[model samples]
Target: MLREFLQSHLPQYLYVIGRPHLARMNYNELKIHILGLFEPTQEFDSLKIRELLSTDWTLKLTDKAVEMALLRYWRQGLLSRTRRAGRFQYALTERGFARKEWLLNNG
Candidate 1:
């Protein structure tokens, strides 16, 4: 059971070890990471994004920081936001998708 757990979870830790700066990412780095989290058809609110960043990326960012980034992306046309269930859920737009690809290649 321990082995299974390690096998399942080792990669996340390994990733963090490989990229120590994730723990202290600046805004542009944070934006790139947040952009990578999106799927073309999926939407995520700030809280959900924050949780994923914590667990998957090993990033410990405040709720306000994540929300502000999301809002900034929305305003920049990189993401689209909609109010649902009293929260703003954000998804990637076409421009954002293109930007993600470009960043992955050049950034």
Candidate 2:
């Protein structure tokens, strides 16, 4: 009962109260945002990733949030990292490529 009420009405109340947009973003939204930063050959470092996330989307997230998202993707085997020139660079793994394709097809 309470779950239904919140699902239907609480969101509007929250919005009217000037709360941060807490709408749940689905996997496709997350995937598209991440894939937009992915380069076939270029490796992304932390600064590059943060810049991409901040400028590309209207939703402004903190650096720590971006780092956490990257870490989550890394743990999911969708991202790989390497050390180059004393800095860590990130790229999508083979599994990530396949997943991206799948999401594109299904959505």
In terms of TM-score, which candidate is strongest? Answer: 1
- Model 2 ranges off by over 4 Å: 1-22, 84-87
Please report, in order, the local distance difference test score of every candidate based on alpha carbons: 0.71, 0.62
State the lDDT of candidate 2 residue by residue for 1-107, as single tens digits: 22232233323332222344446655455554665467566579877887766643334578887777878888888789877887568898888778766655554
* lDDT of candidate 1 over 1-107, digit per residue (tens): 22233234333433344353455554455666788778799898878888777764345677888788888899999999899999888999999999877765555
Question: TM-score of predicted model 1?
Answer: 0.75
RMSD to native for every prediction? 6.1, 9.8
> How many clashing pairs does model 2 include?
0
Q: Return the TM-score for candidate 2, rounded to 2 decimals.
A: 0.67
TM-score of each: 0.75, 0.67
